[model samples]
Target: MHERHTAKARRRRGQRLYLLIVLVLAGGLAWLQISRIHSAAGVVSGQQIAAPKEGFLAPEIQFTGLDGQPHALSEFKGHPIILNFWATWCPPCRGEMPALEAVYKAYAADGLLIIGVNQMEDSGKVSRFQEQFHLTFPIFLDKQGQAGATYRARGLPSSFFIDQKGFIRKIVVGGMNEPLIQGQVSALLGKE
Candidate 1:
């Protein structure tokens, strides 16, 4: 009987050790994620990082717009450009279109250009969405999702705010409201 109890205790101790190891690993991973988020939030809040860390030029993107005209990112070099990657199926992307449209309307004359890069969607859907939102900004078709891949966009509604000099100033990975859009636009315009 004593040998049986000893064996059971040994097994329980082994299980406890395994559980402890798992908890420790999980805690470490969670801490790492939180740290990264805090760092990204600092960039998003425009506190520490003023520009993209890489300092590399914005990737060249050439696509046809809904108006059936060829559009290229390089062509908009003299203006502050908002390069937005979105899809019709994404709820946040849909929700944020109106805010983007309003900002585009208010600031387009100020040399602010908003380019909506649609991901692998038909012209009919994109046209309907644009009509629904009355978005006057140019909407480019990323038929093969090349633009999204070039930008390394992992989520819908990702945006890059580029300065007039054709350098990327800021990148937002999620949906943006009017104030957030305006703040980034202000920074892009050198008003900040």
Candidate 2:
């Protein structure tokens, strides 16, 4: 009788251990499924509002600059603004900064405002990157990525061209060559 009781207790313990393992595996699978679902949803939602129209007045959003001053998109009306959403960690974003800086230098006097909205980066890194690149334009910090969400930035190096009327005229995503970007900028500037 004593031996039978001991065997029964051991079997119950083993059963509990097995059940716990199964529960852990189930939880991990659920997490993976949820993540996949979010990723898919993001992709689909991105396709919906990817283009900018001539008469489209942009949504108002405020973000902190590298200097800690508040910068609002609405304040730069009557000029074409290139709002570039980028991060220090993104290689594509890094690749396009030089081209963007050059465009800014060339057309800044012609009323081109290049607003670099750095996403998910520490200020120190961004400051150092700005110094490294000799980037003269104001760098806005979107630490919480709220500005990215507001702009519907789906990937790194997403950019929007806001025209003189404060309307979004074009949207660019990923790493595009200088000519393409410049063309878009010029088209929005109405220089072409």
Candidate 3:
């Protein structure tokens, strides 16, 4: 009986240890993405936009808007832009949408552009998601994953804050709360 009990306890411990390890690894990976520990992470192959850091020129992207019209990143150069890469299936992405929309509405008149780049999802599903969130910002389709690949958005809810000069000011890899979004936008708009 003692040996049997001991064997069961060991199995349980092993399982717990495995789970703990997984959680630690996941947290570490998230931290790396958020903190930008990997400096060379966004290397483009054969003309792909290189992974950008703070102060790097925002990538020149070619994307299709939901309106079926083509848009270029350079066209929004004079405005402060929040270029977000997300997917409908990502929980963090879904969680951040409301905050993003709120900030976009609050600063739209101030030339704040929030472009939602849906990663590899169908246009219909993305449109439905936009409607579900009551979002008014323009959503672009990264159908071939070219944009995300260039941006090297290691996490699902990544956002690149671009200043008026078209340089990336910040890169956040996790969900952002409303207040944080507000503060960031305020600063970008020179209000803070």
Candidate 4:
């Protein structure tokens, strides 16, 4: 009985030690992620656009719009544009749609363009999603995912804010809320 009790206590101690190690590792990873976000935040807040090293120019992109018309990014030049790369399946993408639409309505009158780049999804699916959400902003189909690849979007719901000069001013990845979108737009618009 005494030997059995001692073994059980040893096992418990070992389990506790293992849990402690896992927790420490998790905490370290969290800290690293937070630091990275802070660093990225600092980098994009400046006046310069944040885009891939590749030059930003007129790419002959013609994709099916929600209204079935071929659209191109060049037509929206001479205006501040918010280009969002998302998919129909991304929940975070779904969550951020309303906020994007709100901003679009509020700022469209001011030459603010909000373009949704739907990647790797069929035109049918894109149409359904757009209609369901009552999205008034123009959504371009990245059928081949070429543009998204160029941006090196690590995941879904990545966004690029382009100034009127056609320079990318900011790149936002992951999910975003209204405040975040508004703040970035305000920054690009040079508004308080």
Candidate 5:
């Protein structure tokens, strides 16, 4: 009788363990799905907002700069914008910093804004990276990867050329060269 009781208790514990494992897996999957859904979000206006792409209004992006100042894409609507998504750890991103800096310097007088959005990283590291590259343009910290995911920046050094009217004129993935960035800027400024 004692042997049977012990056997039952062992079976019950085993069943509970299996059930706990299943629940944990299910919870993890649920959280992952939710994160993906949030990443697909766009502007919350009543208009027909599209999943950020060319010829469409660039999705609203709100993030704090390394200085801890709040910023959003809507605030820069009247100026030509080069919305660049990058990270200090990405080699391609590092490779394009100088070119981006050059572009910013070349067009600052022309009202061109190169906004760098760095993916989830430490503020100090980003600041040091900026110093290393001598980047003068604005660099916003995407602490939660919201801006990066919202912009669909699957690859490093992804960039979006936004016109003064807030439309995404062009979307380029991977690294950009000086001529490519300058050409895009020229086109955004209607100089091309």
Candidate 6:
């Protein structure tokens, strides 16, 4: 009888251990999913800034072009705009330039304007980078980084998608490949 009782107790302990393990695993998985969701929702500077939702007017950006011409975001009011913030020294920004150039060429005839806002870089470096990449899109020099600050670009290779009505439709905060750039451009042009 004692042996039988000991066997039953052992079974109960084993079942309890199994339940504990399952609970721990489930709790861990839940935490991981929550973290992912939070990260995707935008956490910048240790604070959460709500993404500029669709239909919100984009902040004004004024800068001098590499061609010695003044430019303003409002000037591109009638067309879709891809406002990209980048620096010549940023690898990811360099990596994404080709894709930007391709998308610009593919859609420029359709009134797609791509503006590369160089973050506090000298005109010489910007010009060299543009030449090396064979980038034909307009390059704007953000000498004071005002445009970058206004756009709240926390990282290199941030892009804002603006529609014809001058409303910001989407914001991409990292490097983009051809497919991603094309997808965003298509959406901005209302093809998606």
Q: Which candidate has the top score in lDDT?
A: 5
Task: Give the lDDT of residue 160 in candidate 5.
Answer: 92
The residue-level lDDT of candidate 1 at 111 comes to 95
Each candidate: what lDDT?
A: 0.85, 0.83, 0.86, 0.81, 0.87, 0.85
Worst 10 residues of 1 by lDDT: 46-55
TM-score of each: 0.71, 0.70, 0.72, 0.68, 0.73, 0.71
For model 1, the superposed segments whose C-alpha errors exceed 4 Å read: 1-54
Return whichever of 1 and 2 wins on lDDT: 1
What's the CA RMSD for each of the models?
Answer: 10.3, 13.9, 13.7, 11.7, 14.3, 7.4
Clashing pairs in 2: none
Ranking by lDDT: 5, 3, 6, 1, 2, 4
What digit string (tens of lDDT, one per residue) describes model 6 on residues 53-119? 4446777779988876888888878999999999989999999999999999999998999999999
Q: Kindly list the per-residue Cα lDDT of model 1 for residues 1-192, writing each as its tens digit.
A: 999999999999999999999999999999988777555644554443233322346778777787678777888888998999999999999989999999999898899999999999988999998898898998999988887888888888899888776667788889999999999998787777
Error of 5 at 3 (Å): 99
> What residue pairs are clashing in model 4?
49-168, 49-169
Q: Considering lDDT, which of the candidate structures 3 and 5 is the better prediction for this target? A: 5
- Residue 82 alpha-carbon offset, candidate 1, angstroms: 0.4
Query: Looking at model 3, which ten-residue stretch has the lowest summed lDDT?
Result: 41-50
Question: Model 1 misses residue 18 by how many Å?
Answer: 49
Cα deviation at 38, candidate 1, in Å, is 31
- Candidate 4 whole-model C-alpha lDDT, 0 to 1: 0.81
True lDDT of residue 139, candidate 2: 89
Q: Which is the better candidate, 3 or 5, if ranked by TM-score?
A: 5
